[model samples]
Target: MTTLSPARALPSAAEVALARESSRTLSAYLQTRAETQQIEIVDDQGAAHPVRVPVSALRLLVDLLTEIGAGNAVSIIPIHAELTTQDAADVLNVSRPFLVQLLERGEMPFHKIGTHRRVRYQDVIAYKERIDVERNKVLDALAEQAQELKMGYE
Candidate 1:
């Protein structure tokens, strides 16, 4: 299991409440035309500052807030960051041996730094995207087959 140091702390009740409120507000905005435009950030002193962020970044922010609102700890890692084999395996939710096998098979890219193997965060994310696509395809095929067999609800 992963362990956090003393410096890492969970969000307080008030913080969680704010996160939940922000999540709801952001979700509502994201579902409307407001999502296509930039947003303003208000400070604790009621000072509003306008900033334009990429839609993808805003989406990520919403996800983070949602998780935080649900009392989950969040970590933001840069896409170009290098991770150790164990860290990469943890990110992929696989065993180190399995990750090594994938690296050996060229399914995921990795490089050696001195005696240690490092994997790019982007590479792991790309692999996850491919796996998700493949899984969805198989699921769709199965649903089609089931429909042809007149199984389940209409």
Candidate 2:
């Protein structure tokens, strides 16, 4: 069980601009049907290193860059990583007490390690997806009701 660190600060304005440009270039290149791509890295000594990377990894990089470009902070957690209750709550954008209640109610799976509760990253994500689907369903139902009532919500 690995613990994740707290998220870093938001990207600076210059970083956002650079990320936007880089993502645009990489995204355009990714439009090709290639399985892999070669990229060059220049060291401090001005030496160039050509490295081959998978398209999947490049796609993920592009996504990270896109988020940074939008001035948003991002963190990458492995699917199998374990998270503390607070960390899980942060991921779900909820209070720690609320997350604890959900855990106690068995809405999500968790385990205790020396009196501390730990939740799997995958489990937290699954719970979030489940609630998101339910919320969307209720929203759709409400929209339909509003339309039927001629409430001008259409």
Candidate 3:
């Protein structure tokens, strides 16, 4: 079997099901729209006249509507304070290389200005919280196992 690379993302199993459902709803929506409700043409005011478009293109606009309704649009995280990825890594309590690995793996959000990547203070907080939560879960399990084995405690 052939596997797609990370860059060549086809929908995940869940997303594929959602897309199929979206297609059905889209087909229904197209059927219910009036001809005039389908599309509006626009023009640049300098000299050129407006252009015509097909109702088929209406699907493009509505697709974004669905994505927005589904909470799939990019979330705008406030960056009241910003730090370099290395600094954010420190805040995250991980090595700089590990933070870079997260960025490269698309697990972290950052913006590149020139060549430097900056992460928001809020993102740093959230990342730390996530790691701490997972760490605590593992530690809890380890404690339970230690109790069972009668080790590490008197």
The clash numbers for all candidates, in the given order, read: 0, 0, 0
Clashing pairs in 3: none
Shift of residue 93 alpha carbon in model 2, Å: 0.8
lDDT, model 2: 0.95
What digit string (tens of lDDT, one per residue) describes model 3 on residues 1-154?
Answer: 1111222234456765676566566556576445533323456655555444455565764565455445453222235677777667766678999999998887778888899887877777887788789999999999989989999663
lDDT of each: 0.83, 0.95, 0.65
TM-score of each: 0.66, 0.92, 0.45
Superposition-based RMSD of candidate 2 using all C-alpha atoms, in angstroms: 1.5
Tens-digit lDDT track for model 2 on 1-154? Answer: 6877777999999999999999999998798788999999999999999999999999999999999999999899999999999999999999999999999999999999999999999999999999999999999999999999999976
TM-score (C-alpha) between model 3 and the true structure: 0.45
Put down candidate 1 lDDT per residue, 1-154, tens digits, no spaces.
Answer: 2322233367888889999999888776566454355789899999999988766677888999998898877887787788888888888889999999999999999899788888898899999899999999999999999989999835
Judging by lDDT against the true structure, name the best candidate: 2
Superposed by TM-score, candidate 3 places the C-alpha of residue 20 at a distance from the truth, in angstroms, of 63
